[model samples]
Target: MGFLLVLGPLVTLHELGHYLVGRWCGVRADAFSIGFGKELFGITDKRGTRWKISALPLGGYVQFAGDMNPASQPSEEWLALPEQERAKTFQAQPLWQRALIVAAGPVTNLLIAIGILAAFNFAYGKLNIPPVIALVQEDSAAAKAGLDIGDRVIAVNGDPIESFDELRDIVVPNPGTDVDLTVEREGAQKEYSFTIPTLVEQDRFGNEFQVGRLGVGSSPGEIIAVGPVEAITLAFKQTGDIMVMMVQGVWQIITGRRPVDELGGPIKIAKYSGEQLSLGWRQFVSFAALISINLAFINLLPIPALDGGHLAFYAAEALRRKPASARSQEWAFRLGIAFVLSLMVFVTVNDVISLPIFGS
Candidate 1:
């Protein structure tokens, strides 16, 4: 599956974060796997960690010695280990150290994304697309607001705009909402406040969604090369901007502004992965970068059976000076696993139904 291809490397790197951090905190890993199911090939490293590739290519995990299994249930062998060996176990580590190990996974995913985007910007430079309007649609929001071709967008919501994409970064998500836009025409700057209309558009992949349309288009703009330092700065801002948009998008979906069906799971990702592959290496890499950030954000959520969830427990441990009872942790993890599995099943079925073959 296309999702598996992207998921393999991303997930492996995620687990690697846990493995490396655990080792740094004096915790030993039982295994560092690249995938799930039966092991295909494996070798015990010098550190005595079994590193392996598994049959399923979807995702992976790192198992720390003396730590509870995925279900938060303790392992018998882990419990049976002598006190000296158990001292180096993940469960025996200081609470802060345990927290660091869990946090490392999501942080590493974010780092991978930043590195990828930084490389692209440093190499190809960023497109310098000015906000100069080349076309205006009649009976649209811009037309209604007396916007004309040749008008250049200077600011949106009082924030100065650097590129047309920046203008879009403000407007696209605000469908049917009023915004304050400043434009320059004939050497004079004027402000136009208008309400954007909902524009329902379909992509080449047959996904349909509604977004705010400004009713203005621009011709191809120049590409401006930047020095290494500036490229990294821009890359950071770009990555941060996209992350904010993602969080906003989720909020919109929860508030009923975006469709519930638009919530994608693995199936949608697999389809997009294939499409990106056909587009060329650049687009495929971009997709992977986006997925990387998505993975980081998702894992950081305070849900049960997730890194964020573990971090939440650590936070509690810090306050109480003691960990939660074993029974409570077990119950919490069990409920978290059930919720995650049910959500996956629901989304996978939604993905199948949304396929073009179904015509639903």
Candidate 2:
């Protein structure tokens, strides 16, 4: 229930971006349903789009007028529509407009994340921990970088580091990559370069990943209030940082550098949502923002049956001066749906196994 509440808003906002942009581009939508299957209730606006909640309560979709179904397949009848009616269909739009409509959904998710993060930073300023080393793991990145106790980290890769957490945000995603560190010790600042080793570690749930280990600890730090400008600025930076981490995580898993088991589905998200809700609204909002960012990034993957997939087709359309043959598109979407459903089943099974009732 908690997960649905969080997910509903994010999903709705994403679809809304598509609907609004499609309208702006003169495309007519047949239905805007917040779930699949039977409709709970709906209303057709003057523009003739049916907006409703569906029984499924899982995810929502926008059915364009010329689309054969929810997957946005261009129908033969749609192709044979009268020239006058074709003007209002999605296929009639120019390549740029079609691409914009398809991309709007993911972009909306990103904007939602930035807004939530900026609000949090403005209301309660983010903490900036001092980069004073408290503990260092032997043979870790910090150890090889010649860092020691009482050494204060000044910068990473020539970028000035203001907090320990900031330093981590830069290092955590770049395992097996070299990082330059400048530290202050004994009244002198010196630079050291070291590689972040790819260390495999497991979470409490036994999900493993290859992560860059700094092998250092720090004390609690003070906080400073950020002005409106800086808050928004930091919010964008934070969003980009999360996006980078998500991309790296996906790449690592695909390349066999990280465990595939770490990939989570709805169940793990629901559990985390419940935990965050228990902590309070702030934590839950942060989690939702993270999820929104992840949704945006994931949807941008060039897989068929997703927004990115649609964009890929549009790219081909632009290049070839025509859309891919309907038969080819159909096959691509079929394979894509099969792959997605299989992944969902696998993740759901993992989620069940990770349940406390089954032994966490």
Candidate 3:
């Protein structure tokens, strides 16, 4: 129920982008349906738009006026009409307007992410931690090197350490290698060189690896309240950071640098949603935000049967002063559908194999 509640809102917001933008462009929207298949309920609005709730709750659609067939084709009947009446048809609109309508879905998802992130930052303030030392493990590398608790680490290997995250980045990879640390203890500055011990640990992605273990923790810093403007600014930065990470992951996969075991599908997502739901609302919301971003990015890829594919076709038409041949367009759409279906099957199989159901 919670997952549906979360996913429904995001999906609705995405489709609403198409509906609203189509209406603004004077392209009549015949049916604004949430979900698919059998209609559970529907009503005509003042503008003669049929707002409907369908049986399938996964996603929805906006049917434009003069969509030739129930399958959403270009209507010859509408095209044969007088020029003035045909102006409201989707194909009749300028290419730029059509492109905008197509692009709006993914843009809405990004905007939704930014809004959610800003709200989260505003409510929670921000988690702040300093690079100051709190505890040094006994008989550890620090202890063997004459480093003690209460020593404030100012730099690592001559690089200024501003946050614990930065310090961890320096320490985690170079296991058993000595790193010079400049510290301030008892108001006196001193440099200590120590090597981090090697220990096997599992990462969040379920990959196990050996990494340096310092057996030290940082001191907590004061939480600072951010103004609305700062919060929004940081939110955008965070969003961009996440997008970068996602793109890198895709690149790694494509280059065979990352294992395919990390790939997941709808089953994995549903399992994750259920697991996160047990943890708390905030955790689930974070998961949803991440998934929403992924959806937006994937939909924008220039593949057939996708918004990007349509926009690409529109671009070609604009440049050549004519649309692609109908036969070519049909074949392209069919190929795209096959590719997407095959991908879905592959990911679904992977998900099932990785789950307890398959006992793998």
Most accurate candidate by TM-score: 1
Question: What's each prediction's TM-score?
Answer: 0.90, 0.87, 0.75
**Residue pairs with clashing backbones, model 1:** none
lDDT of 1 by residue, 212-322 (tens): 998899889888788889888887888899889899889988888887788788878999999888888899999999999999998998887999999988898799997
lDDT digits (tens) for residues 197-222 of candidate 3: 87768645453445677878777777
Q: Is candidate 2 or candidate 3 better by TM-score?
A: 2
Q: Which stretches of candidate 1 lie over 4 Å from their true place?
A: 69-80, 184-190
lDDT of 3 at 131: 78
Candidate 2 local lDDT, 1-360, one digit each (tens): 779978899999999999999999999999999988999999999999999999977678888778775346557787789888888988778889989999999999999999999998999998978998988889776777678998999999999987899888877777877889899998999988888777777755454556787889888787889999999999999999899888888888798766676788888888878877877888789999999999899788878898998899888888899777778888898888888889889988988887778865
Candidate scoring better on TM-score of 1 and 2: 1
Worst 10 residues of 3 by lDDT: 67-76
Worst 10 residues of 1 by lDDT: 67-76
lDDT of 1 at 169: 78
Question: Candidate 1: lDDT of 315?
Answer: 94
lDDT of 1 at 82: 95
What TM-score does structure 1 among the candidates reach? 0.90
